[model samples]
Target: MTVDCAVIQRETPAPERPHRRTEGPVRTCVGCRKRELAVDLLRVVAVSNGNGHCALTVDQAGNLPGRGAWLHPDDRCLQAAFRRRAFGRALRITGSPDTSAVVEYVRAQTGAD
Candidate 1:
């Protein structure tokens, strides 16, 4: 008499494991267009500079109201974003918003002039 092992295995249930949370929120860099952890990228937002003009500001703490864009803290990424105008589009602003603040922040962070 031969017992069917396949039948016995099919009747057994597999153990379930709990889902594990390992990483924080992931964001895409508007400059390099690469996915990265939110903690690794700088958050940027557009705000009025009191002259009815919108300007880009770096959210160092990553907690600011309004649409936010992510970017790598590198000079290459900064230049790429400027060349492609990714900042204005990502922040949903009309015309070229002032980027002096953002540029300075990146320079300071990267130690670049």
Candidate 2:
């Protein structure tokens, strides 16, 4: 007489776990074209000058009512943006945006902090 033994294998279900949030909101820098957290970048909005021309102004508080563009607040990025004419395309403006105010704001903020 002969005897045989058999073994069975089965997989147990994984325990249910709560989903964890990984990343926060991210935005691309129009100047450097780098992806970064929205909080880390400065937001700019397009404003009309009442003369059929549009300009960009920095929204330090991140609460403006128009289309917003993101920047790094760095001199190199600012210069690259201007050189590439990214503001007009980003804001969909037909005229050159007055970036003096934005530049001054960034300079002051960077200097202070």
Candidate 3:
């Protein structure tokens, strides 16, 4: 019954908006191609030693710049990614993944097995 013009400004066409794009960061999962919020995916980095028992490690802070791989917090997804060499192929290098530690980390962080 009442239109508050002061509260609802008229939607008159304003000058063309500048070509500013609001982009959000994204990272792809090793097991899945779908891009996810950058922080949503776990970062996997190739360790320094090319040959070592644990040559792969997770980047909890996402600070390392060397090529990174992603894995969901889900256990099955992580298992599939590791089983399929998705991380290695994505990063093109690999030695070892402290899977137990990673699982523990994921569990503590995501609380999802």
Q: What TM-score, over all chains together, does every model reach?
A: 0.77, 0.75, 0.62
The CA-based lDDT of model 2 is what?
0.84
> lDDT of each prediction vs. the true structure?
0.89, 0.84, 0.71
Per-residue alpha-carbon lDDT of candidate 1 for residues 32-95, written as tens digits (9 for 90 to 100) = 9998889889999999888878989999877789999999999999999999999888988888
lDDT (Cα, 0-100) at 29 in candidate 3: 82
Model 3: lDDT to the true structure: 0.71
Candidate 2 lDDT, tens digit per residue, 31-107?
A: 89998888888898988888887767888787788788899988778888899998888888876878888889778
What TM-score, to 2 decimals, does candidate 1 have? 0.77
Off by over 4 Å in 1: 1-22
lDDT of 3 by residue, 1-113 (tens): 99767775688888987863336687778876667876777887776644454456678888987888888877777777868878668877645455666667666766632
Residue pairs clashing in model 2 are none
Best by TM-score: 1
Error of 1 at 67 (Å): 0.5
